[model samples]
Structures are given as structure tokens and as C-alpha cells.
Target: MSYLSRSRSVYGPTTSTTCLNKDDEDDDDGGGKTDNNNNNNADDHPGASMKQRTRIGTWNVLTLAQQGKLIQLANEARRMKLEILGLSEVRWLNFGEHRIPSGQILQYSGLRGENAPRHRGVGFLLSAQAHSALMKTRVRNLTIIQTYAPKFSLSYDAADLQDKENFYSQLNATVDRIPKGDIMICMGDFNAKIGSDNSNYERFMGRHDLGEMSENGELFAEFCGNNDMVIGGSLFPHRRVYKVTWVSRNSFTEYKIDHICISRKWKRCLLDVRNKRSADIASDHHLIIGEIRLRVARIPRQEERVGRQFNTRRLDDTTVKRSFTVELQTCAADIPEGGSVEDQWTAIKNAFNVTSENNLEERRGAKGAIQRSKTRGAIYSARQRYSALEKKVKRSCRRDKRAWADSLADEGEKVAATGDIRLLYHISRRLSGAKINATMPVKDAIGQLLTDPTDQLKRWFEHFEQFFQVPARPPSPRYDPPRVSEPIRVVAGVRQGCILSPLLFLIVIVEILVGAIDREPNRGLL
Candidate 1:
């Protein structure tokens, strides 16, 4: 089937992969390739022929909770041959990994409470190919966080300042947790405008960035600098349309807020980063894609069955909470007190598990059906009205079109506020397309690329073996010091969150460094 026909069939009449009108085409910067072959070529460099190429993309899907949206996204990824897709505002509840019927694995993180609105969620959808190479996933509070920073006209408030500080703190903690040797790609809707100025920030930024820098942009740039990450979008040459991820409802303004960044050490792995304006999803945001060549090993299978997650949401009910407490007490009482520490621990664990099974709810199926139905119906109605307005704008005169567009924009906000998640998502998507991609290839000790998954794994093993290899110890000193008669006691390590922990750590590190320096044989030469 033709691409257009397939898109129409899957997405319905309102959405099309092609531009709405000839004028829309004119706005396009021609940075994106429409043909599949062109895309494949664009993703692979001539020198990277022997390397395995993986396409990673990021898009603000508005909300994954929308009916059929998750499946639609998976299909789109398949069509585009994207190996990994990072999604923002997924709106999925809780934190977990799920395998879709298509064999794709989706790892999502969202708010914890059952009563919490499905908002500001983030997730990664990995194709079978990418899923096989997955090593680990770390979810942090602010890693996929979103907040409304003060705009140019708005003065900064205490709440806004606190929010920004909290975001930065969480972001730093997340970055610190990443293994330095592993390739890191950090991308999202930063909501910061990093202009074309490469001044002082030349190490982490490029001249290709669009618009002038904002206050948030400074924070973004500083974060990249500290983490040694390079902005992917700023390094590539693309048209204005391809560079800009957002457009105003009036169509008179555009901004490049969505960005993808990678560790500067793995910058060469990124082949390209550009906006795919032709993708026809309900969301207004264009998809941002990045190409990289990397080798990855499949995870070994295990025979262990995963445990069922306890629905902690049930604890909100007073009756359920009371029942759970009574059941837990009863179960614990049955465990005998006369046992070894290990046996007692195991018995206590079993008691909790049994109580949970009996008292806690099981989260095995779709949740919030009533709310979902209401939201879905509202979104559908809003979409129909928006479609009508779009058609009218297309056929109307310039002045009338502007008025209609403004009305359409206002209507979108109203639907969003009404908890029509899909409509709200499309509005956010149209205004800010946030996406990110990063990848790194595996190589052997001799710098030879390892294409096979098994070879990649073996190469990593060999590389680490050599890296951690300790040299032979020198012969023991002829004169050994006499052992002390007094008993030596070692203090326990400092608690992580203690006020003096950082200071103590710093002091210990300094002492170690000083001792090492004092003992250095080459100290006299210095």
C-alpha cells in the first residue's frame, strides 16, 4: 500500500503524512527525507557501513492514555524503523515495564498516587531490536519532569523558583547516577530557547541553534557543560522548519524548544537530528528523530517469574487499609519467634506477601475506565470541531483564516482544561515537540568494532577485565613493622543524607590524596 493510503487508513481522514496545502510545503525546510531509502541513507554514514545503525526518536505524544494511541505510536515507529522512541507526557499511571502485543517493550514512569491525574509522565518504547540490547533503566523524579517556567512577560515567583531548583536538583542526581562509561542521551522538552549564539558555551552548544537564549536556556547550557553533553539539534544543519519544533496558533511565530542531546564523548555516534514534519499524528508537534550507529548485546533470559505489583492505591480506602493491617497482623502472628535471623526474616517476608495477596488489589488490567471514557468522548468531539475549523481556515480568506485559527487555538486550550487528554496533548505537541536520541557502538580492546551481539558482550567482558587488571605487587619490605597490641576499631560509614556526610567524604578523599602524594617516589622530581 502507498504510504499516504496506509496513513489515512490507520489515522483516519483528519490526519495525513503530507502537508495540508502547498503553502505548508513552502514552510518546510526540506531537511527531512520523505523516502524510506533516503532516511536509511541519512542515518548511516559512508564510514559507518560496518556498524549497526539504530534510529532513536523522541516525541511528545501528548498522552499515551488516549485510545489506540500507544498502538498507533508503535506502528509509526515500525514504519519509520525507529529502534528506540522516548515519549514525553505519556500520562501512564505508576512505574513499570510492559510488553505490547507487537513485541515492543514500553518502560514508563509517572506519578505514584491512584488519585493523581495522569500528567507529566515520561517513557521509552523500545522495538524488539532495541529491547534486546537494553541493559538497565533508571527512573528519577525529574528525569521526565515538566513544569511551567516564567515566560518573558511574567515575573519569577517563589513557587516557580522552587520548581526550577527542584528540577535542577533531580536532574543532577539523575545524571550523577549514569555510569560514566555508558553512552548517555538526555533529551526532552526543556522549554528553553537556546539561541544561535555559541559564545562562551561553545563546548556544549553549536551555532545552528535557533532563536535567542532565555534564562532557562542558560541553566540548560550549564547542565550540558557540567555533564559533558552536546546539543544534537544545534550541531546539525537543517531548514528553519526542520529546526523549529513549535509554531504559534496564529502561524506567525515559531520556536525551537524541543531538543535532543548526547554526551560529548559520543557525539560522533549521532548521524543526524531533525524534525519530521510530514508525520501525521493527532499531536501538533512534529517528530524529532536521531540516527546513531551502535552495537548492543541481548539480555540473557531467566527462568524466574516476575512478582505481581501490589496495588498500593487500595490503601487510600479506610476499610481496605484496616483490613490490610488486621490481615498482616494475623499472618505475622503465625510465624514462630524462635528462629535464626535469616529464617525469621524469610518468615516475616512470607507473612507480608500473604497478607498483600489477600488484602491488596491486583493491577492486572486497564484502570480508570470511567474517567477514560469521559475523556475520550470529550477529546473526540473536540477533534471533530477542530477539524472543521482547520477545513474552514484552509478555504477562507487570510483575515478570516487568522480569526478561525485563533478560535481553534482557544478551543484547544478549553478542551485540554476539560481533561480531554488527547486534545491537550495535541495542543502541547503543536506548540512544543520535545524529543531526544543517543547511542554508542561497542568496540574491542584493539578498537575493532563488534557487530555481533555475542561479540559485543565478549568484547565488553575483555575490555573490563583488562581495565580492572591489577599489576603484580612488589616484594614485601624486608623489615616488617611490629603489629600493635591495642585493638583497632573502624567506624561505620556516614549516612548518605547526613549534614556532615559530604564534608566527611571530602576530608577522607583529601587525606587519601595527600597520603598518596607523600608516598610518591617521583615527589623529589616535582
Candidate 2:
């Protein structure tokens, strides 16, 4: 084949793998997320045990071209506690890793070039922990290759056939290149229903699958059989609700199109594969998470810093203030008066949280996670209500953020008139968004800049290790000192963050001075 033929995709050069449109493309009315009964699903635990398991999932978002969708999707991923999420129909141009503000890494492959039309794309959004695992995969070598395949069709269209062939052929080549020893996980929106019948293809899939085998299923089964990848989802038996990944926008009909498969050698490593309906990105498809039993290195958090506080300026509004006050009063009423300091603090924090959640972000429930029940009538009404609520919330948030900036600007102007340089500079920096990265990266032994967070942490650990090393001295008396008694447990009179802590400290110092003067009058103690 000529380079030109291989370079361009079936849907032209704009999109390489997935077709631009499919009947299963959208859920315009959206779908219900956050089902209460889904708590009993496998992989519900947060994998906080010695046997560190990683949660990897695949999703068909249809299109991520819209605003705020990616952030909402990321939040959903965090709530689902997924380590890695493969995405389809991302519709983002170019191929690269984009580290979002949330510290998650989004590594995507889309149409190449600046002018490439944003169409079908495949990508992986990795949590900080998951990215750390991928970086340290030498200890646990694992490779994941995801794809976005065209849907099955009735007509024998040449273009459609070409698209399907392109996906399978590319996938086959990619699978062939992987080492036999490495665990290979192949997942994505195949759009192929393998059905519940395990006839002839028992080795590749399980009989627990949903729906009837379609034309595309035959090809997918053949592909997995050739590759020796056992379908992870089918291997585990679960209710049909857990298995269903795609539902019609109307919330009536359902199908299982997305899949997660593991190479035969590591089939036992796949503990569970299920759909998380709660992770709604307003798409027809649900997030399919697979629990792979691998000891992943826990990614250490970055240096502790105060997180962004809420824009409290909104409380200045009378209606908002009144609502917040009422909610706070109700929440406070629920708290007991007598408790330990820690318990009381926690209660107060909860009270604040409840009030803020109620009044501050009023539009928060409008997003994809708008308390869905999955019924037809519920989903329809929810979608319509969400559509209207979403706009209102977005506009309200934008206005509030803008007002905060304006208030900062106004404060800066007043401070300028008062000649408070520090206040003016602080306000200016806050309003300008702090474009410059101020954190200085660490250096390796060779003095190369360690830009990756993991590498930087490693370098810092090495530095600290060498810095605290015991220095060799001339052989002095080798007598070991006698063990000292346990130190006294000291507690301060005033608690930290108390307004009168400094005042109480001064009072204590005054008492010491008074006692010293009374005991030994001016014995050069001054």
C-alpha cells in the first residue's frame, strides 16, 4: 500500500479510527446517573488494601467539543475512583498529554495538525496515581491500547467496511507488537453486541453477555479469539443493569456495546468489569470500569497548600445571605452543644459545608449528575430540567466569578490611592490569574531539570537522604550515652488558630517575669 493510502483514514484525514456518526451516537435527552441500587455492584470498594488494584475504564462521550463537559467528566471519574479512563469521540485536534487544573493527565490521540477537523478521537484520562503507575510500569509491565470502532450496519457500504477494516487491522498490528509477558488490556467502544450465546466462541467471551449477536459481534469475537483476549466483562456474572453500558436516550432500550478485554495470560488479574451509571457525561454510554489486580505505586500528593476557597463575595447579596443564614441555622441546630474540640470542630465544618452546598452552588445539581432514576419519564423530565438549570447555573457562576474579579480590581484601586503597594500587588496578581509557574523544579545528580512530579519527588528524597547522612569523625571515645528518660508531653494553653493565642502567650510570659522578679530581685536576670 502507498503511504498516502495508509496515512488518510476512512472518514478522511480528519478522523483516523471512529466514524463521525452512528445511531448510538447520542443521548440527547441525557440519562440517569447515581442509582441507589448500584451500591451493591462489584468494584464498589475504593481498593485501599495491600493488594493494590487499579480501576481502568472506557467511555464513549460522543463528543467533548462542548464547554465544561471535560471538567464535569473529570469530576465524575474522581467520584467513580477510576484510575484510568479511555475516551472516544473526544473530537479534540492534535495528539498530546494535557495536564488539567485538577492534576489529572489527559493523554489523547486525535487527527494530526493544527487545521485537522475535530472529529473522532481516542484518548486516556489518567488520575495522578494512575499516571504514576504508568511511569513506573517497569516493575509491573502492562500495556493498554484502546480504540473507537464504527457501529454495525445493515447496508454493505464500502466506506463503513473500510472504517471497520481500518480499526481491526490497526488493532491487530498494535496487539502483535506487544510483548507476550506484558499484561495487555484492550478496551473501548466496539459498538458490537456479542450477545448471550457462547456458541463456538466460548474461549473469547462468556455466555452472560446481553442482546443478540450482530454482524459486528462476529468480527469482534473473531478478533479477540485470534488475539487470545478473554472478554473481562462477560467472564464475571452480574445483573443486566451492571452489564448494560449503552441505553437509548429515552431510557427504554438498552445494549452492551462497550467492552474491556484482557490477554489470556492475565485473565485472572481482571477482578471485575462493570458499568458505573453514576458517571454521566450526557452520553448514551456509561463508564465501564475494570478492576485489574496490580500493585500500583501510590502517588504521593504534592506539597500541602490551601485549596481555593469559595467566592464568599456572593454572600453580600440579600437573597443569598438570607438563604445561607437559614440553611446555616438549620445545620447548626442539628449539632450537639457539648463535645470534644475535634468533634465540635467537625460538626461546625459539616454545618458550613451543608449550608454552602445548599445556597452557594445552587446550580451544581444541573450537570450530568442530576439525580437520575433511569426511568423513561424521570430521565426525560430530568434532561429538560437539567438543560434549563445548567444554563442558569453556568451564567450565575460566570457572573459571580467576574464580580469577584471586579471587587479585587476595585480593592486594588482603593489600595493604590492609599499607597499600599503590597495589597495592590496581591490584588493585581490574583486578578491576572498568576500566569507564571513559580515552583522551581529539582535537579538530578547530573544536574538535569526534573520536570515530572514523580522525578522531582525522587530527587528531593535523594537530596534529603544524603543531607542527613552521619559524617565520619576521628575515632573518639566509643562510650555510648545513657538512654534519657521519656520527654514530657507539653500542651499549649491556647489552641492553634485562636484569636487570643498570642495574647495568652504574652500573659504567660508576664507571669514568668513576675515570678522571676519576686524570687530573685534583679540578680542580673534582666
Candidate 3:
């Protein structure tokens, strides 16, 4: 009846909502009437309260060449209390009305392609009971691509690395299509590994190309990192004994080939990874399972339970297995110390809720770095091409000069006429800066003509003739262009032209110092 009692009643019955720890406490109001009233309110609002843990599992069912094993696998999944199940390596016959005995309904779909006949695919199995509990929704932020890369066999020696690159590119584009703030789960078997290992039960840390130390594995690491996904369930406590999927009926060597990866935003949502490894099963590969916490609305119908409320998408069977395994490793690593299963789920909820601008900026920076590296590489290539072209041009110029001098002898008659002689001598001088003198004014005049138009050339020629009282010969012993590698120095006893102004001298000195420092560390030492 009093304010304190009313306030106490409003905040009553605390439930654990913090990370990794759950503790329950009941506080009574000062007035017994407040407690009675609050209890009455709680009774009427059953939908307003209730807590449930949602379990999700992922597996790569190397499609039992037999229908019976497939059904058994589905039933086992149900028996395991898996509310949501993702399966890879599902043949078409294993889908579309095939009965899963757990009485659970798998709302399934597959990728569109010409290989449909092979029926190799990925899908989701919703416990029919679980499906009946929640509301249904869909999100298509990323494109789920299922591909079986070429194995390094004698028949296919050429590497499928390029194909893998293109596939990842497409996958990233699909992930980008999803708008920010929307829940997007891009999961499946990416035939790549974080790294090679003999362990199926132990934690296998993924590596990146950054260094020899493993972060994630090669292209797989790059793909998952670029999309911000975690490789769940791979970091468990057991070494893989039978790791390979898709085994030939007679082959004995088993390889750990499948993997699962998820966005970093959903890191906390991951719970546990279960891998079934008994060799007695008809399927060659072990069944992988991923457990996830579902935050369900308390008041939903059976179909509206957490099942329908959580966003779901279908993946290829092969991809599902791969991603499941990857996620298994990642989830194991994500488990914080001293947290309940509930706490782990809560962490995932908080982690995957929404991507912040900080995340986008980080991705942008990474992409920008890649783009810049590519741009720099292209610039270097262009410079190399230009340098090659410059050398070729120099060689051709030298050859042309030799040919022109040889031709001068054939035009001997032109040397006898003034205008013809001037033209012939000009051409020769232009071809090679090897001759000149006042007596041979034609040669000197030709060299002057190179720097000026005909009018200025004529004036220079006239001035030369009048000053020396003879024909204006080209300056004997023509000037040769300096070689790039040669040190520029005025010869002893040779006239050095007028020097530049003091300001120009200062600028030149500063430029020289900067250039010297940039090109030669020894100069700085000096």
C-alpha cells in the first residue's frame, strides 16, 4: 500500500541476466499486501516470463549411400534434443518429403544449379515440436555457396585455387548484400581448413597469411576474416581420427577436410560442438553438431517458439559440415571462464546483435590496404615498361644516326650548291653532332637551326658570317648530349658559363641536400 512497498514489488524476483553467472533472489515488500498483489500479477502474465535454452546443431552427413542411415541420423539428432539442425552432404533423395523419424520437421532447401541431379546439398531441420513454438522470419544477407573443390588427384593435377578464390569473392559479395542491423548467418562447409591436424577432439587454432603462426588457415582464414565470422567447434579437446568426408567405398586413408565458420558478431551465441566418430556408422565422416542459445519470446505458440522466431537459412550438406566443424573449434575457444551455458548464449546475443561503425571502418581499412598494395604494384609495373621503352628508343636513335651519315655520300652533288649544301649539312648535323667551323658555316648554321625557327636561324647565321667575315659554319666539334650516368664537370681551361642568382643557388643547394639524403644514406653520414 505504501510507496516503498510498491517500488519493492515492481523490482521483485530478480533473475540472472549478467554474463556467466545466474543467481536467484526473492525480496518481500514491507507490506504483505504488495507481495500478494505482485504474485497475482505474475500469475496473469505467464507470457511475460519464462526462460529457455535453444540448442542448434550442424553436421556433414556424407549422405548415407543408404536411406536408412540418413533417417537414423535425423532421429539421433532429435534424440540429442537438437532444436535446430544444419546438415551438409545431403543427396536430393534425402530431401523433399523424406521422413526424419524424430517427429521433427526439417524446413529444407538447396542451391540452384545444373548439378541438381547429384542432389548433393545442405539444409536445416527444425524439430517439428520446436517449429510449432515460435514465429517464423527470414533473412538473406549473405549468399550461401556450396562447392566441392577439385581434389589433388592424378586426373586433376591443376590446382583449383583460382576457382576457390572466385567462390570466396562471390560469398563475400553475398554477405555484403545483407544490410547492417539484420541478423545474417552465413554458415556451411568451406572445404578449406584453419590448418592441418590429426586431432578431431582437440582445439585446432586457425591461422592467417600474416605469418607462420596459425591464426586461421590460408584462404579459409581470409574468407572468414573478411566476413567477420568465427570458425566454431573446431577447437575441441580431441585429435581428429577420421577427418575426411566423401570417402570412396574402398579407400582407407581418412583426412580432416570439412570446416564451419561464422561471423564474429555471433561469437557468444555458440555453445558446444559435438562430433560423432564411431567408424561403425555406414557414413565415412563423423556427424558434427553445433549448439546455440536461442533467446525466445515467452508468450509464443508451439510453432512460434524460438524455432520460428530465430532467422534461418539453408546450406549445402558439404558446406554445413565444413562450417559446423570450423565453428566447433571457434566456439570452444570463445567459451569464457566460469560461465553457464546460459551465459555463453547471452554472450552470443550481445556479440551478434549488430555490427558497429567501428567494425565497418576496420573492414574498410583492411580493404583499403589491399587496394593500395595493388595500386603500388601496378605503378611499379608501368615504370618498368617505360624504362624498357626508353632503352629501345635510345638504341634506335643511335642506329638512325649511323645510317644518315652513310647516306650523305650519295648526295654529293648537293654539296656544290649553296641552298642544297646548307640543307644537306643541316640534316647531317641533326643526325650526328660530330662536326662544325666558320669555313664550314653550313654545318654550324644547321646546329643553330635546331634551337630556333628559320627566321632566328637566318639571323644567327648572318651574325656569325658578319662577325667572323666568313660563311657562318656550325660551331666545329658539335656538342653531344650528356650521358645520364656521367658526372657533369667543366673541363679544365674551359669557359664555364654565367652562374645563377643567389636565391636560385640556395634552392639548388637545398634540393641537392634533400635528394642526397633520400638517395644515399652515406651522404648524411658525411
* Candidate topping TM-score: 2
Give the alpha carbon lDDT tens digit for every residue of 386-476 in model 1: 5554453334334554665677689887997798988777666544422212223455667643445587788878878999999999998
- Candidate 2 residue pairs in clash (backbone atoms < 3 Å): none
Model 3, stretches more than 4 Å misplaced?
A: 1-53, 93-102, 110-116, 134-159, 182-186, 196-217, 234-254, 278-281, 297-526
Error of 1 at 331 (Å): 75
For model 3, residues 64-137, the per-residue Cα lDDT tens digits are 44424555566566555554555655553322323344456443333344354544455556555443333221
Instruction: State how far residue 442 of model 3 sits from its true place (Å).
Output: 94
lDDT of 1 at 168: 66
Q: How many backbone clashes are present in model 2?
A: 0
Candidate 2: segments with Cα more than 4 A from true spot: 1-50, 130-138, 298-321, 338-376, 393-526
CA lDDT, every model vs. true structure: 0.60, 0.68, 0.42
**Per-residue lDDT of 315-417 in model 2, one digit per residue for the tens?**
9899999989988988899899898999999999988977786666544454334344557676777767767776764576577678888898889889999
Residue 467, candidate 2: Cα error in Å is: 40
Clashes of 3: 81
Alpha-carbon RMSD to native, per candidate: 27.7, 24.0, 35.3
Q: Which of the numbered candidates is closest to the native, going by highest lDDT?
A: 2
